[model samples]
Target chain A: MKIAIDLNGGDRAPEEILKGCLEFLKNHPREKLILCTTKNEPDNLFDLNHPQITVEYFTHAVGMKETPAKSKKEKPDNTIEGTLRLVKNRKADCAFSCGNSGAIILNSVDVLGLKDPNTHPSLISFIPLYNRPPLAVFDVGALGNYVFNAELYFAVLHETVDIYTKLYGVKEPEIKLLNIGTESWKGTAEHKNIYRMMSDSLYNFTGNIEGDELLFTDASVIVTDGLTGNIVLKLLESFNVLLQNFRNFKDCKFDNNYLNFLIEDFNYETIGGAPLTGVNGKVVIGHGKSSSKAVRSALELCVKYAEI
Target chain B: MKIAIDLNGGDRAPEEILKGCLEFLKNHPREKLILCTTKNEPDNLFDLNHPQITVEYFTHAVGMKETPAKSKKEKPDNTIEGTLRLVKNRKADCAFSCGNSGAIILNSVDVLGLKDPNTHPSLISFIPLYNRPPLAVFDVGALGNYVFNAELYFAVLHETVDIYTKLYGVKEPEIKLLNIGTESWKGTAEHKNIYRMMSDSLYNFTGNIEGDELLFTDASVIVTDGLTGNIVLKLLESFNVLLQNFRNFKDCKFDNNYLNFLIEDFNYETIGGAPLTGVNGKVVIGHGKSSSKAVRSALELCVKYAEI
Candidate 1:
C-alpha cells in the first residue's frame, strides 16, 4: 500500500516532516510513500534514488494563526491539500500528515468527505499509565458542538480498540467508556444511552469512568464524544506534565530528563494520524505541532489502520 | 460553632479520630466537638481523654461492606445517623464523617434534607493540579443521572467557590467550565449556553478550558457532572497511589516515618475526603478503606469547611 505524505502544515513543516518520512521509508522497505511538499525542490532534499519513495512540490502551506476554515479555503495549492487529493484520487491508499489537525480534518472532510454523517475526524490519544498499557482516548478536540449517537460511538470505540490492541499486542483489550461514574448508567443523555447500548454490546465496556479514572483504570480503550474525550485526554497530558514537575521539585532537578525516562517515548505521528472512522475513503489527520517523530508514527498507524 | 464527629470510621476509627478531635480542641478551644461511636471505649485497645471533646457511644457500627442505603435504613439508630441528627436538630452546626460517603449523603438527605430541587448532594473534591491553585471538582459519584444544564452547574461552582475562598483565604476564586476544547463556541448545546451565562454572570468566569490546559491555566474551580468528576478524581487518586508505590520501591521499605512526614509535618492532608456540596448541612465522607490519617484529614477538612 502506498501513503501520500503531507510535507507542509506542522510547526517545522517540510523540513522535519520530510526527514521523518525518509527515515520511515528506510525502516519499512515493503511500504511505498509519496511525499507532497511546498518545498521549492523536494528531490533536492533527499537522494531521490529510492524506488520506495516519490516527491511532489505544491509551493504553499497554511499558517498556524489562520482559522481552519480560512486556511483550507484560501490555500488550495497547499501541500496538505495536495496530499489529501492523492488519497481522493486513489493514487495513495491513505494520506499521512503532520499539519494543523483542524485544517487536516477540514480538508479531509472537504476532499474525502466524512465517512458518515457523524464521522468527523477525532484525535485518538493514548497514555502509558500504571500497570495498564496505553489507554486510547479518542477526540483530543475534534467535535465542538457534540452529541454522540450510540452507533457512531460504537464504531469509534471499535476502531480504537482494534488499532490499540494491534499496536500494544495486548490480549483482549478492555474497552471502557469515558464516563462520570462507575455504574453502567451515568453521564449526559448521549453517554447514558451509549452505556445502555454497550451493556448489551460485544465490547468489554467497563461502564462509566470518572475524570480521575482516565489515568488509572485498566481499560485499553476509553471511548467518549470528541468534546469530552479531548478534555480528558488533554487532562491526562497535563497530569503527566504536572507529575513530572512535582517529581522535579521533589528531587530538585533543573531538567525533567530523569522523570522522562519513566514515561513512554511519545511519537507524534502515532497519535497524529487520527483515522476518520466510517469514511469510505482512507484518511487521517495529524497535528500542526508534529515533530519528525510524530510524522513517522502517523505514517505507521495510518498504514496499519488503512489495512483494516 | 460545634461539629459532631464520627470517632469510629477508619482503621483506627475512634482512636485516631478521637485523638485528632482532642488536638483540635486543644488548639481551637472556641470550637467544640461531639464524638460518637459504637464505642469510643478503650480496654487497653485505645486511649481517649479530652476534657472538651464529648464522647457518646451509639453501640452499633456500620461495616464498610454494608450498602449505605441498607445501613441507613436498617441502622437508623446507629451513630452515623444519630450524629447527623445533631445538625438537623441544630444542636451542632454540622456533622463530619470519615466513614462511607454514600452513607453520609443518604443520611444527610434524609436527616438535614438537601438544598431543594435541581441540587442534590454532590461531592466537591479539591484537585491540586496545573500551575494554578487547587480547583474544586464536583459530583465524584454523588449521583447517577446527569442533566446538561449550565445554570445548575453555575450554582455548584458558585457555592463551591464561595466556600473554597473563605476556607483557603483567597480574595476571589476564578471559575472555568471543563470541556474537550478551549473554543469560544465549543461544547454541547447546554455547555455553550452555560458558557454564555457564565461569561455574562458576575462570577470571575474564564472561557472554555481544555483538558491539556487544566494544569497550566489559572482557574480555581473546574466544574463538571458528578460521574466525570468521580472518574478524574479517582484516576488521579490511583495515580497518586501508584507514584507512592514507585517511591516505596525506591525506598525499599514502607517508610511510615516519611509517610507521616507528608501527613503531619507538610500539612498536606495525606488522606482525601469527598464533601457533599450544596447540601443543607456540611458532611465529610471518607474512603471505606480509610486509614488513621485519612480519617484525621477528613475530619479536619470538614471542620475547616464548616468554619468557612
Candidate 2:
C-alpha cells in the first residue's frame, strides 16, 4: 500500500514533516510513500534516499490563514493539490495533510471528487468513552457554513455509518442524533425533519442524545450538523487544558503521570488525524500545528485507511 | 422585595418547593415570599404558618414534558402563569420556577412581555471561572430554535450587557462572539454578519472566541445563538460527571474532597438558576430536577435580581 504525504503542509512544514516521514519509514520499511513539497524547500530537508520514497515538487505552499476559495482559485499548483493528485491518479492509496483543514477539504473535493455532490465531506472523530468503544462524531467542520437539510444530513450519516462499521467491524452500529434535548420533539424544524428521516432509515437508529450524555451514551455514532459538531469536538479536545486550569485553581503541584493518565485518550498526538469521509479517495487531515510525532501518527493513520 | 416562586413547577413540586421556601425564610427573616401552588396539593404539605410567606392557589400545574405552546394555549391559569402574573402586576418584584425552560420562557414572554417585540427573551448564565469573575453567557435556552439574525442577536446582546453590568457592577464589560474560530471570516454567513454588527456597535466588543477558549477567555461576556449557547452551557455543567467517568476509567480511589473542589463552581445547587432577561419583569429559571437545596438557591437568585 502507498500513502502520499504533504511535506509542505502544517505550521512546521518541510522539516518536521520530513522527520515524520523518516520515522514512518523506519517503522514500515516495505510500505511505499509519495512526498509532495514546494520547490522552495531547501535541499537539506530532502535527503531521503530510500527506494520506497518518491518525491514530488510544487511551486507554492498554501498558508495556514489563506482562504480556501482564494487558494483554490489562485494557487492551482499548490503542495496540497499536488499531494491529493497522487491519490486521484491511483498512484497512492491515500493522502495525509496537516495544512489548513478548510483548504484540505476544498482541494480534496476538487482533486478527489465527492461520491455524491449532495453528500458533503465530513471528518469522523472518535470520542473516547470509559469501558465501551469510542463514539464516532461526524461532520466536525467540513460543512460548517452549509445549511442543514434532511437529504444532505442523511447522505453524510450513511457514509459515516459505512466507514464506522468498517473501522469497528460492527454489522449495524447504533446511531444517535446530537441535540439540545433527548426529547423527539425538541430542536429546530430542520432538526425535527432530520429526526423523522433517520427514524425511518434502515440503520440502527436510536433516539436523540443531549450534550451532557455525549460521553456516556452507548450509541456508536452521533450525527450532527457541522457547526455543532465542530464546537463539541473542540470543547472535548480541550479537556486537558480545562483540567490544568482546575489544578492551578487550587495552586497544587500535581504529579504529571496522573494528569497524563487522565488525558491519555484526549491527547491530540495520540488521535493523529481525522479522515475526510464522503470523498472518493481516502484523505486524512491533521491539526494545523501538528508536531513531528503527530504527523508521523497521521501518516500511520493514512496507511491504516489505505490497508482497510 | 417580595419574590414569587412556582411551587408546582419542578419535578419535586410542592414538597421540595415548600421545603425550599421554608429554608429561604429561615435564612432571610425579613424577606417576603409569594408561593404559587395548585389546589390539588395536600393540606399537610401546606400547613406552614410563616407570616412572611403568602400562598397563591392555581387550578393546574404545567408538566415537565409538556410543550410550551400547548401548555400556554390550554392552561391559562397554571401555577407558572400565576407566579409570573404576580411579577407582571407588580405584586412581586421577581419570579422563580424550576419547571420546563421552554414553558417558562413562553409564559414569561406572554405575561411579562418584551421591552422590544423584535427582541426575544434570553437567559443570562454566569459561567464560573477559576480565579476570575464569572463570565456571562447569553441566550442559553430561551431562543434555542430561533433563526439567526443580526438585529435579533444584537438586541439580546444589548439586554445581556445591561443585566451583566447591573449584576457585576461593571461600567463597561468586554463582550465576545462565540464561534468555531477566532478569525473574522470564520463561521456561516449569519455569524459573519453578527460579528460585523457587534464590531460596529458601541459595546465593548472583542473578536470571535472559540469553544476551546470558552473557559479561559478574558472576555467578560460571550454572546451566541441559543442552540450553541445551551449546548456549551450543558457541556460545562456536566464537567463533574466527565471527571467521575475519568476516575472510574482509572479504577482508582480518589478523595471526594478533591473531586468536590474541582467541581465546586460547576455544582448546580450552588449556581441556583439563570435569569430570563429582556422581559418587563425579572424571571429566574431553574433546572427541571431541582432539589430542595437547588430550589432554595433559585429563590435566593430571584431575590438578588429583584434587589438589583
Q: Each predicted complex: what DockQ?
A: 0.41, 0.41
* Tens digits of lDDT, candidate 1, B9-59: 655576666656655566566777887776535644334455556666786
User: In terms of docking quality, how is candidate 2 classified?
Assistant: acceptable
Q: What ranges in model 2 sit over 4 Å off?
A: A14-26, A50-52, A244-261, B245-261
TM-score of chain B of 1: 0.78
lDDT of 2 at A208: 84
Give the per-residue lDDT of model 2 (tens digit) for A73-176: 89999889987899999998988888878889999988889999788777987765555556888767654354666677788777778777876677689888
lDDT of 1 by residue, A1-308 (tens): 89988776677877888777877887898999988876664456766678898887785777754567777667778877888888888899988776666677777778887666764455577665534456677655565556667766665666666666776788677777776546554566777777788778855765766565565566777777666666555555554554443343343332334334344342233355566555556767676567777788778777776686
TM-score of the A chain in model 1: 0.79
Indicate the DockQ of the complex predicted as candidate 1.
0.41
Best by lDDT: 2
Candidate 1 chain A lDDT trough over 10 residues, lowest sum: A261-270
User: For candidate 2 chain A, which ten residues in a row score worst on lDDT?
Assistant: A245-254
